[model samples]
Target: MFLSGFYGHQAAVVRGPKQPFLMETIRVDPPKKMEVRIKILYTSICHTDLRAWKGENEAQRAYPRILGHEAVGLVESVGEGVTDLKAGDHVIPIFNGECGHCPYCTTKTTNLCQTYRVNPFKSVMENDGKCRFSTKDGEPIFHFLNTSTFTEYSVLDSACVVKIDPNSPLKKTSLLSCGVSTGVGAAWNAANVQAGSSVAIFGLGALGLAASEGARARGASKIIGGDINPGKFDKGKEMGMTHFVNPKDISKPVHQISIGKGGK
Candidate 1:
């Protein structure tokens, strides 16, 4: 099967913002224990993708790497000893897999799965913890975020593939793989927002809107949104924002807006 990937020989090399992505053909390795080969169908560009392309996150990145995190695909093959999935099963690739056996996974406090903790810059998908992708000429290429969904196919651990309904739209569901989950999790899982409580959200981007939506879904009494741009205020109001504060127009400090509400 054909696969897609990008390579950067040099770090911090500014390719124009509108630079077109280059595609390459490569062979995918067979999955090892608890691993699966996925035939990717849909992937999306997130802020992280932009940051990586601009080399803004170079410190945590490696050269000649494949970059992608959000994805949805179908299982094309499974590794030995894998039981829960088989070929043809539909799945979503979780950028961060949760190893149920780990203390952090057991607590379910966050998606930071313990067993998969390998430095992306220095590691690839080798069973012995080494690089997996290499050029025909033998130069190694690093795997980005494990999922590498930009490719038409991906090899991922079973922990990273969550089975979902087969009939679900792959393109739309792909969003839930990262952006949707991150935004929702930050509100319910991280902040633990309570129902009928008053809450104020900063920034009105996708994350902020998701937070506001979560609060509204949780029965929050009031949701105040703060943004430097007044243009976003109208959209924020449409998304259940009870109050919109333009930081520039305020006479007093922004912190005072939350005054007497027990906030610092």
Candidate 2:
């Protein structure tokens, strides 16, 4: 048997700056066609999760919503038409799976597919044009970002499950599903970093480090990382950063160090 919390009627409020997460439980529906049931093992905290919890972007959030996105799990069941994944397959949930046949997916312009419309604002059941999860009392709870990993178990589209090597550590691979993929893909695919080119990364947090790593892996000749924190400088250097610029001290533009002729 699978379990999940269903978000009921709850007032939204931002608790505090650092401590923003509001704990609550809500109901979620079962998987529909092309969806799958996952038994969540681990999930990671992300800035998006914190922001949504804090009500920083409350207008976009639904009440009693499950907020975590980075997650790893084992497939407990598969919906009809899902032939690729089977029961007991270890996978990482990808919130941004685009329908491969869409225009954006065809052009590789964006991963935001047009086919699937799993609304985060409404109860998962309502948006799918049917109900999958309901409170024991029959109330509906919202599913955030299609894959509500904050809960113990979640029903998600098959497109959201990326089957990885079962031997891989779920804890580490979970990070790759969202944060690592976003930062890395942004640098390599979005920015189109050429080999032997100079790259400047704006932030040095996990996303920034991932971007730097992506750039380095692509054979960037010079990778300059900038951050406000002085403590992160050493770690940035160890991560293939050729130069560290503390924006608080540097008066010149960081793009000046770019090896590319055109500013990116």
Candidate 3:
């Protein structure tokens, strides 16, 4: 059942690798089954976004794409069979889609559902290999990772959206959609970090800081953060990092300093 309405939205699109983003007006069709139309509220740039823009990942992506994955938005409309969410709901767009029946999804050990593995480079909706966005001149616009958060409005698979607390602050909570959550989950789920153990995390960016917090939560005795720049040390310390290591200052491996022993 088509909602019988079509709309246009503005998006920052990368025409090709290393090219400046072009603001383009795109035609968006109504949501199909198990999809939702989102009115994007806020979106942020991530290192992955930069990598895609630089064509570092071009082999895994197509051109004329809108790049963004961290986003918070409002549900403008829902497609048929979208019962768990509806219009007026606030949500975060997840780059990873979860098909409940997939082996990975059912196992609960990982977020890599096989539904997206068939064509990792294709940015189309999971249910279809086509794009819902088009240039005014009828050119197809490839989505960036399934969640083109750089657009004013976006259509997403219901499996890629998670409804959040209505009263939660949108701007801050948006971090949970990507970077921060990835870091925390890496420490908890991926590493299965043990309590009272040492954790050495490289980089002092948002992810590293979030990992520090996760380590602290797990009762890590010593959390060491390594970065080339000491400017971020204070910020990392505030996030529960017990020590900081500037790799440039140390000729030896930073991990050795944290462990105070030779390689195992």
Candidate 4:
């Protein structure tokens, strides 16, 4: 019912493939039902954002769009039916949201919500299949993923936001919104990495480094990092990795080496 208070804010907008981002003033609509408005305090650009920025896939392209996902912010306002959070709460926007009562969320097999799975093609709000951002002249701007944080202000489904302890550092906490979480979640949950177990990870970039950190936290005795670039070896060691394997230098695949087949 509250659709009257729209505030003007600046956002980086991309209109075409490989185009420069335009700084445009857009009006962000107040949250609708089960939504929340956030005043972004910190944001991080991820590889996913880079891919979307390139508009790599023609079919997935949506012009005049706001693209971002990893960020930390404060809850500016809560929409109808949002009782768990209030204004001034610290939060991080999650691209993959969980609608607590959904069948998938309730099952032990997975945590993917039935309706809020990450969809590159979904450029609108879940509540009304419409855009919450628009040009000052009223032209609609598309949203990227479920959480768009490339602006000073953003609106997202309440489920997409996780309230955190106000004491947490918003800048560092933003990592949990995407890259760090993706890697750690994979190593901890999907892989079920156990204490004292040996672990091998390929491609030691930010994601791999995060996985190494997770493995280290689990008491992994041997954290072997694999990457074509030797430059990452130093950083990998800093993350508790015990060894580095460059697949290009060896005749055998890194996986085969991990399995005990010696690589040259």
Q: Provide the TM-score for each candidate, comma-separated.
A: 0.79, 0.82, 0.91, 0.92
For model 4 the local lDDT of residue 39 reads: 90
Error of 2 at 208 (Å): 0.4
Full-model lDDT, candidate 4: 0.88
Q: Kindly indicate the candidate among 2 and 3 with the higher lDDT.
A: 3
Quote model 3's TM-score.
Answer: 0.91
lDDT of each: 0.70, 0.71, 0.83, 0.88
Better of 2 and 4 by lDDT: 4
| lDDT value for model 1 | 0.70
Estimate, for each residue in 1-264, the C-alpha lDDT of model 2 and write its tens digit. Answer: 233334452222233334545544435445667888887888887887777776665467555456678989899877767889988999998777666787777885546677544344543532365444445576555566667777667778787788989999877888987788888887889898889888888889988988888888899988888888979988887777887778888856777756433221
Q: Give the distance in Å from residue 24's predicted Cα in candidate 2 to where it truly belongs.
A: 5.9
Per lDDT, the best of the predicted structures is 4
In candidate 2, the residue pairs with backbone N, CA or C atoms under 3 Å apart (3 or more residues apart, or in different chains) clash, namely: 5-26, 5-27, 6-26, 6-27, 7-26, 7-27, 28-133, 29-132, 29-133, 30-132
Give per-residue CA lDDT, model 4, range 1-264, as digits (tens): 244547568999998889999999899999999999999999999999999999888888998999999999998888999999899999999989888788887886435688788788999999999999999888889999899899999999999999999999877999999999999988899888898788999999889999999999988877889889998999998998987788777566656655664532
Candidate 3 local lDDT, residue 16: 87
Q: How many residue pairs clash in each candidate?
A: 0, 10, 0, 0
Model 1 lDDT per residue over 1-264, tens place = 222333322121122332555565554556777778887888887887777666664576566666777888899888877899989999998767776777777785436666664334533763556554555566665666667777777778788789999889877898887777776677787778788777788899877887887888777777888889888887887778887776777565545554434221
Highest TM-score: give the candidate number.
Answer: 4
